[model samples]
Target: MKANRKLVAAAVGTAIAPVLVLLSPAGIASAHGYVNAPASRQAQCAQGTVSCGQIKYEPQSVEGPKGLHSCDGGNAQFAELNDNNKGWKATPVGSSVAFTWKFTARHRTSNYEYWIGNDKIATVDGGGQQPPETVTHNVDLKGHTGRQTVLAVWNIADTANAFYACIDLQVS
Candidate 1:
């Protein structure tokens, strides 16, 4: 009888192990997304254009609560992205360019917004659908020139969160 009881306990542990791992922080961290084109700060880190910490491994995981304007996506683990002196490479772009996002986990999106400093230059309505593996938007940089940093926000439709990506650019 005791042997049967021990066997039952072991079976239960084995059954729940997968569920526990899925619900862990590491699991959720693996499901978020970030910008890849124009090569966002995190993306640059991931691509070795810049030296970074753990953010270099999970470039898509810089997600945070929505309505907040921050490059790190409010995650301290990725805080290095906010450092301007990290020698982040700026891609040369025209006045109008396509900014693309490579999503590892696509969520229902509310919108995509782009900013240079405090000015909002463009916004694209997301239509509340799961994005493709990659989404691209045409952003106008009309009066902007020289070295500039653009902040892109991917607002999630069903959650109080968003993903942020900062891209350095040399607009010509």
Candidate 2:
């Protein structure tokens, strides 16, 4: 009877192990990367400039499938990032501003692209090499001005997905 009980306990543990791993923070941490400077929506939450849920813990992990442009990275847990009414502070930036990215797990990059209000503003070709801990690009705002949201994308060189970071800016 004791042997049967032990066997059942082991079976239960084995059955739940995969579920536990999938729900672990390490699994989420693998998502990687976010805009650090200029404070992307997730960054603000992570820094306590804004109150958020799970994203506040792993701000660098607000990732989603590529080709979609959304501030929350399509992760509903980070949907707070999509909330415009949260009073997300917009950083004042010049026409040519330097944007920085913080990566927890750096992957090979195909390119970096930036968009402001439906217009593609800048694209930096990142020759299929892993970036440093932090990467910065000087984006030319050109004719854009006033308040705007900058959507930055880091396209993975080997994967079909990309990480997205959206920053609210007061461009001058």
Across 1-172, the per-residue lDDT of candidate 2 in tens digits comes to 9999999999999999999999998886575799999899889988999888898888887777887778887888888887889899999988888999999888899999898867899999989999999999999998888998999999889888888889999988
Model 2, residue 43: what's the lDDT? 90
TM-score of each: 0.88, 0.84
Clashing pairs in 2: none
For residues 1-172, write the lDDT of model 1, one tens digit per residue: 9999999999999999999998888876576787888899999999998899999898998899987678998988888889999999999998987999998888999999999988999999999999999999999996999999999999999999999999999999
lDDT of each: 0.90, 0.88
Clashes of 2: 0
Lowest lDDT 10-residue stretch of candidate 1: 25-34
Per-residue lDDT, model 2, residue 57, is: 86
